[model samples]
Target: MAASQAVQAKLSFLFKAANTQFASCPELSNFYLHQFQKTADHANVPLADAVQRLCCARCGALFVAGINCKVRINSIDASKRRKTPGRCRNRVRITCHACRHPTVTNGSTTTLLKAVASPGLSVSVAPPVDVPTGKKTKKKKLDLQAMLNQKKAPSPSSSSFGLDDFLSSL
Candidate 1:
């Protein structure tokens, strides 16, 4: 069956169940159904399952789950002394219903939990470059006579006083 059709079927089942469970109140049923549909659409999963997972028995806040879930294996390079060949071992992502913790499933067991610390896990955020404010430092104006005298003092044929010589020095 198509994914959309499966989703609709599951939603209908949840709606009916919710209505029956809530004493068949039309307004309550519609409200619950709307909430279930919204949660399912956001999570891209079955409506009933998503509703069951998010709705806390104690406090009724919708907890977000299955975020930043990934499974990766780093292959060490013998020559370079660095783990370069990073590969994803599993593709199936799972989220815990009670705590909203994301995990990567490998077979029946969850290999990587959402809280496990790993190298290269933190995204590299470049620091903002220092922008020059409107304030400009006052530069001393060069004396033309002094400059000309200094140039004359140096040998003209030597070509050491040129812009190219200054650049090369830098």
Candidate 2:
């Protein structure tokens, strides 16, 4: 058991060293990173496996700053986050040079909200369900005057959704 743990720790060290050195000497860093990957795969070490996921599996490049990857911060504030333009959400966009792909991840605020809202804490977090992250989405023009002039429809006594009706019956 101890021997396996030591091997896992050594692999983690190699991963960290490779990450730091990747920007300066990609070839050497890749050598070490690849070594760690191969070892982790053979041993099926969970810690090293998780670390490997942070790198481009194909290129063995570390997801470090302007090196082989880039992360962009997108933050949405709480006041403006519930509806309208204000639905609060935070995202981190990760782009890998090897894959030529961008992946979005939850940012600090989303993580904090998750921590608070987990069943143990019982805090409620309402995240917007349909906001699109695709580049093709056209930005809607906001006209405050037109919005203020719109009429408010009266609420129905019964739920309009079949799912809601089913839950209500229960």
Best by TM-score: 2
Task: For candidate 1, write residues 32-150 as lDDT tens digits.
Answer: 65565664666576434445544332222233333212323343344543232323333344443534455432221122433343564864569998765544312222456667777
Clashing pairs in 1: none
Q: How many backbone clashes does candidate 2 have?
A: 5
Runs with alpha carbons beyond 4 Å of true place in candidate 2: 1-6, 48-54, 74-88, 110-170
Show the lowest summed lDDT stretch of 10 residues, model 1. 105-114
Evaluated at residue 22, the lDDT of candidate 2 is: 70
Off by over 4 Å in 1: 3-31, 34-51, 56-110, 114-116, 122-170
Q: What is candidate 1's CA lDDT for residue 105?
A: 27
